[model samples]
Target chain A: MAVTKPITRFTLFGGVVVLLLCLSVFPSSGQAPKNKDLVHVEAYASHKRVNSGKSFHIIITANIKQGFHINSHKPLDEFLLPTVLRFNETKGIAFGSVCYPKPKQVLFPFSPNHLSVYDGKISIFAEGKVSRNISSGDINVSGIFTYQACNDQMCFMPESVGFDIPLKIVKAD
Target chain B: MVAVGGFLIGIILFAQVANHVHKIFDPLQIKNLVSVKQLFSAKIPEGVPVKLPDLIITTIEGEQLVLKELTSRNRLVVVNFWASWCSPCVEEMPHFEKINRDYQNKNVTFLGIATKDLLSVVRKFIVQKEITYKIAMDDQDKIANAFGGVKVLPTTIFIDNNNRIVKIHKGYLSQRELDENLKDLLH
Candidate 1:
């Protein structure tokens, strides 16, 4: 038994090295908190007139995973943070007000007691008026979105998301 | 004596291992420590008085309360916007309650407004938390909009005697922050 002491120490050292190596090799996947949870955005036009001076619509949607809900554009309590969407206006392009979808009420253990939020998916619609004199072709619209996602346990810090949508413009009738 | 020494060493090792495991599992503690450090080190914006939009809300007792009325008593009004489902709001309630009690006679008034929430829930939360400060329900979120549209839970607006907005704090404020704000306002 006395002769085996050095061998045991070597085994312990080897085990620690293997554990460290495994930890270093397997980097964590930077997935959003919930599995299969992600936010998606899309753009559409009421009329396909993709012409200069034509009005187009952009709808940004966030699809939450099952059993999870995102904070509402307007939370129930004044102290609860409200979700905000930011847009950068481009030359010759005019952006309209953002229309937020209605949120559902939720209950939790925290104070003033209940909150309002959107579960599964929600959409924000905005109208963009194209420039009247632009040469017909592909037009790019872009903006940044800043919002905070929260669960029953905690609220994540606000995250900024940038998106660009391309549209085909032609002559308006 | 040797056995006792060995037992103590084993306990020490067990404690160390347990602590390491706990640290790995508890990310909330790390987040909280970072927030605490930010609270202590961040530059606190200076309190400035600005006129706020007028708002009226209904109290739990079914009385109409106007924002302007709070300014009549030459009091420093602390308006805390909170909901029952916000953890930071819950954590900070006791501190506000304490401040309300400690400065009751010091011309300081604390008003808690529940925005975008049901009145019943706000009433229950107030009762459960043993909050003695005046609490009102902003059914339409009008009050919140008047306060520059709060972007976070536990956002507190400090109003001076003249009903001017003196400070706007966003996020879960520590007792220390509240104490300092109160000290500046009270004096």
Candidate 2:
């Protein structure tokens, strides 16, 4: 009986080791889906302080989710909503035409035609001028970034992200 | 060892307890779990049987539809997932309508499902575009998500009289592709 005891223990340990190996091979079915956000927008002015009546640059960057893309400012498809950026009328700042970044033309598996789209991250630049009549003080300028994000298969609803940029006004340099 | 056996038993007991809790408290989640299971098991088959749950759809024409019921009645169902904002979807809709008309006497039902679209906007757009097929809004996007997440607009799924989904085409279907696919699947 004593001699058989070691063999019994060895057999039990072998069974446990085999079970552990099988369990490790067939792991859990992956994490549950979280309705993750698709896009984030950030904006900043070129200079910390710009003199009144002088021109400064406003740079805006859109970070799109990995699998999604947005139509360019000038998309080839007429029906697609093009990304548009515009600043609201403000007392301190006035804007000029925006310079949109170049877009990648991709022929998706689901598209018959190649689409001009912006993916990953893209930066947009615009020239803003401080009003000559405005006093030297901190000013807030609001703007909107509008886009429709889509993956290869479906497009999300068109949405807009608003940005408020603060500028420090000073005498002309 | 006893410890290993206990661990295995614990996992089994925990799963059983969670299943019972869901059955008692949240029946809707239990229903969704079935769909999720079916989704993984199903592949858009060119030959094999594609099994799906009987999901309810309320069309714009105010008629309720059950996909399994329609297929069981010796009718083929063509479901197109589309949106008003999808340009390719809009472009190919007229072609879909023409094919729909061609199969008037045939045992085929064409349902245009507008996904991620406002009901009012879709109604107005369809009227302006002269779409005559049965239209419905997938407001919650549950229908599209079931058919392998319809990652593209203008995806088409064909269910046969046996209630098996035979084909799922993702992308714009030209008139020729639409006609050929319908003909091939019909016979």
Model 2: per-residue Cα lDDT over A82-137, one tens digit each:
99999999887889999999999988755568889999989999999988888988
Q: Write the per-residue lDDT of candidate 2 for residues B1-187, one digit (tens) a residue.
A: 9989978876875565554344333432232233555433223422223566777888988899887787787467999998887766877899989988888898788899998788888888889889999999988878876665655677788877666566667667778878977776665
- State the local distance difference test value for candidate 1: 0.67
Give the poorly placed runs of model 2, Cα more than 4 Å off.
A1-40, A63-68, A88-91, A102-114, A119-121, A133-137, A151-154, A171-173, B1-76, B87-106, B118-130, B138-187
lDDT, candidates in the order shown: 0.67, 0.76
Q: List A-chain TM-scores for all predictions.
A: 0.70, 0.78
| Residue B37 lDDT in candidate 1 | 49
True contacts kept of each: 0.06, 0.25
Best by DockQ: 2
Interface Cα RMSD for all candidates?
A: 10.7, 7.1
